[model samples]
Target: MYKLKTKETDNSVIEFIEQVEQPKKREDAYRLLDIFAETTGFEAAMWGPSIIGFGKYHYKYDSGHEGDAPLVGFSPRKAKISLYFATGDTEREHLLEKFGKHTTGKSCVYINKVADIDEEVLKELIKQSVLFLQERYPGK
Candidate 1:
């Protein structure tokens, strides 16, 4: 596997976000930065190339695949915003229903526009996802 260039929790990610072209996207990114900072109790920093991540967790699997990654984070991709929760939450389906226009993947929640969703509800979603991961993975 190619090695992750930035050492998992570096400020490089933050710098990358401030440089996004779209004004709305930049504002949305900062909003996420504030929310994640408060919720995860870890300072918001960049993870990898373009992800705004909160906290850090080193994980090891029975198969010996072990490494460190952000506990909670999101990336503003070209198509949409991708948020990583690190665990599967069945109840998240309920939130997404009222979350306006959005999509869900295996362990991520995606939103096209921040205007299409409730900011408060979105914060709760992040909180719940982080808690679920904490319960499953135990500490970062």
Candidate 2:
């Protein structure tokens, strides 16, 4: 069985944000916290050591691999802030066109800081991610 390393924990999200070494990144993390929480209408929770996640859904793939994951989340890493959204969503790609200074990986959007991107777009991304997940993994 494969284990998921980013399982949600009962850790304090505020404490984790406070421990961020860079003052600017720490501040950006706080702002992201508010954005994700308000947009998702769900409280933030700690996922693993770094990720602050809001809302969750259970997912079981065709290969029988399954786990619960946040509907949306972010991590303020040393290099940049990683924004997590639903994978394979075309709407996400479209929204990113106007998201401003950011880079995308397979499942994350990396930004140097909060000011580098549009907050309204971020909120829309958050909303779409939650809706996508809820529809994909209905009742889970």
Candidate 3:
């Protein structure tokens, strides 16, 4: 059995943000917190040690692997901020075309700073991720 490490915990999101070493990243974390919360309509919660996540869904893979995860989340990392969104959504890719300056991984988008990306596109990503997960998982 594979173990998942990024489970939601009772950790404080504010405390985590305050502990961010870089002042600029700390400020961007605050801004992103507000954006994700407002856009997703879900309260922020700590996902493991770093990610500030909103909403949640449980996914079971074809290999029988399953776990609960946030619908949308972001982390202010030492290198850059990582934006988590739904994978396999075509619309997500389309939106990213206009997402300002950012790089994408399988499911995580990396941005240097909040100011480097368009706020409106960020909101759209949050919205699309939440919707995609809700539709895919359907009330998990």
Candidate 4:
């Protein structure tokens, strides 16, 4: 199992977000933090060096891969913000239509800025992602 760096609620993450270089990126990070917190009913934390993660779950795959991970998270990258919906590839593309202008990873949705996306739709997508994960990995 990978060591858990911070608790579900940690101040380091807040400090990191505040220290982000770009004002626009920092603000967008805060917006993501707020929406994710409300949607998941969990506070945000710094997952590692830069990821502002919300909520968490521990999972063990039948293949023997097992570990604890954040339920959803986002990182303020140089060119965009990456929001992690672990179930993105598993099932969540339907929401992408209304996700506005954003790139995607197997488990992440990358947006240049919050303004470039629809907050309302994004919020719903976050909520949906959480529900989807819960249904897929309930006890985790």
TM-score of each: 0.84, 0.98, 0.98, 0.86
Model 4 C-alpha lDDT per residue in residues 1-140, reported as the tens digit of each score: 55546445455877888788999889888888888998888877777677777777777788776666788888898877888885634346777887789887766788899999988888877787777777767885
Candidate 1 residue lDDT tens string, 8-107: 6546755788788787887888788888888778887777667787777766778776677777888888778888775657767777777777888887
lDDT tens digits by residue: candidate 3, 18-123: 9999999999999999999888888999999999999999998999999999999999999999999999999999999999999988779999998888899889
lDDT by candidate, in order shown: 0.76, 0.94, 0.93, 0.78
Prediction 2 global C-alpha lDDT: 0.94
Q: What's model 3's overall lDDT?
A: 0.93
lDDT (Cα, tens digit) per residue for candidate 2, span 13-39: 999999999999999999999999988
lDDT of 4 at 96: 84
Question: Ten consecutive residues with minimal summed lDDT in candidate 3?
Answer: 131-140
Q: Cα RMSD (Å) per model?
A: 2.3, 0.7, 0.7, 2.6
**Deviation in angstroms for 97 in model 2?**
0.4
Q: Please give the distance, in angstroms, between residue 11's alpha carbon in candidate 3 and its true position after superposition.
A: 0.5
Clashing pairs in 1: none
Q: Can you list the residue pairs that collide in candidate 3?
A: none
Off by over 4 Å in 2: none
